[model samples]
Target: MRSAVQIADARANKPGHQIYAGRARAIIERASIALRSSTWVPIATGFIEPVLYLLAFGYGMGTLIGDISTSAGSIDYTVFIAPGLLATSAMNGAIYDSTWNVFFKLNESKLYQGMLATPLGPLDVALGEIIWALFRGLSYSIAFMLITAPLGLVPSWSALLAIPAAVLIAFGFASFGMAITSYFKTYQQMGLIQIVLLPMFLFSGSLYPISVYPDWLEFTIKLLPTWHGIELIRDIWFGVIDFSSFSHLIYFLVMIVLGLFFTTRRLRDLFMR
Candidate 1:
């Protein structure tokens, strides 16, 4: 038999103990079931959209724009934009998975309601949904990298690091997106996501160098998560690993923590109430 002190410790730990293991597994299992019922068309479509952007801007417009200067030195317009597109794709995939899909599950299908009725709690649901978003984002990132590699866009083997970097980006955005989604009670609020994401996509140093912007605007863009992601991916693609690279990693890690904190707190309030 366990000692009284040991039993008390076990009981105390039991409240949230399963969150890191069992609850997460349950959430993932739920996602897998939903994915099995879904079609591949949407996945194929997501992969295609980024490729279209690369073709349109990287090649079609590259002819007119010529070479661009980057921290990695002057490079073809296509080469410079390619990694940024990969970052964009990862961001888009994660946002879509976490926001709209999660909204529908939270509100329409009442999915989280059902999960909360089980042994699972808000934290489990939050993590599971974010992991699923990361899964979708990673898939898109891998496909984008494969396409770019043969085209000579990924110049170094260090580009393989892009996969985990993409996951970190996705985790940050997905958690952030989920946290935002939790506060929204109506579909009309979702348009706000577009308003925010579109500008970040355009101005986050993804399509153009931040040097084109004034100092204030450039500093603001650097604060955006996607800009850090773009810079991180660009560095990995060019084989430039340094202290700044680790700083980008830290930025995303911090975002992920903040996102999870807000998401879990919001979910508990929304559901527990």
Candidate 2:
């Protein structure tokens, strides 16, 4: 009893044919509209937390510690930790949007379900949301850099690269965060994310060198995405571009690809099936 139009639509959406409809811009537009009316407190909080860390740890503790040695040579303790905090800022912003916000939309608002009911495919929704999260990350990075540069915490023009590096870091985290969030059904499960993130932020070489850890622990920290992100931003902040810099870039590129793949698949299973 199916009409021809319904039959054609089914054929178009069958299995693997229409995972993306090239309408993600619509989702981005919707996000932007929502953001315009949203409270600025959360965004301000993400920005302020890093600034406070920079003040307390970077300046206050930095005075007692003096200059620290990095791959870029001995630099002010303030300078060394600024990039790590910058990377952290980006991570916090993107993860907030992609995880908690995405969770609300997925479970509470049922936004993604409605989006998929339209012409938007799962890939479109996934990519759109990730891109919007990247915007949050980019904003945090820019605002942090603006504050740091005036304080002489930014050592070179090359440090501007950290902004883009922060975006890449955000993209990787946001992609994976959304994918992982799709699996959670309860607020208790969501608390586990904070638990993981807190430790990762502390031990990811943000405050001190991982060299202080046991060799096994050092290796484990290096395996973390945040460590790579911090290292990449730190290298740029000090203008230490090298083969290793490209390696860190490659790590995020791979993270992005795999995250997007899993997120798209999970969304398809949730709404399209």
Candidate 3:
């Protein structure tokens, strides 16, 4: 009877009942350690991918396209696409971390289960992973900006805010990506993410104006998160801050809230019960 009562008390005090344990930093530390030992090839690729896009589209195509008109007036084609690529860079980093890494830990390693068995709660794990993903996104943004700024790609000091804007974009995708990944149980299912991302990057006004499409197609593209991210960074990149900018900010804020809510709930459902 005493053993049963003790066990019951232990269960009652478990971290599963709490939304957060305030030990998310621990998880971040764990990720940093693991990253140190991992191959650098993947990280190098994430950084290089956007740089290649910028060079290929900004310089190669810019010559053919000439200046493009934005709300800020006629600008170089390279200037117009730079922020879009920054947003893409951020999305790529966050998606890689949140979707693939989280999927591996959630399924193959059972890492979250082990963490929960300790004092850490589901929110801690979710927040930690998302923040860790943000680091990857941040690195990409800073590195890209360094290269672009020196090459006369950045227009003004205001464009520096693109780094933080990229981080915000990353947070939105990382949160949503992790929440979505928690539902997958196999590698085959993971391929769906790539299927969606490629089309999104192509059609989200990243390379060219969406206005080229019909009104219906434009509206559909506008509905995507990537479009908002591109616009948000572009506005800041061009120093065109306005009411529409705040609306885009709100969109990602909502995404982060909803993603975290669903992810915490899902983790509890999967492991707590």
Best by TM-score: 2
C-alpha lDDT values of all predictions:
0.86, 0.90, 0.90
RMSD of each: 3.5, 3.5, 4.0
lDDT order of candidates, top first: 2, 3, 1
* TM-score per candidate, chains pooled: 0.92, 0.94, 0.93
Candidate 2 wrong stretches, greater than 4 Å: 1-17
Better of 1 and 2 by TM-score: 2
Expressed as tens digits, the lDDT of each residue in 110-200 for candidate 3 is: 9999988876789999999999998898898888888889888899998999888899999999999999999888898999999999999
* Residue 118 C-alpha lDDT in model 1: 58
Question: Which prediction has more favorable TM-score, 1 or 3?
Answer: 3
Q: Which ten residues in a row are the worst by lDDT in model 2? A: 8-17
Model 2 gets an lDDT of 0.90
Candidate whose lDDT is highest: 2
| Segments in model 3 whose C-alpha atoms lie over 4 Å from true places | 1-17
Clashing pairs in 1: none
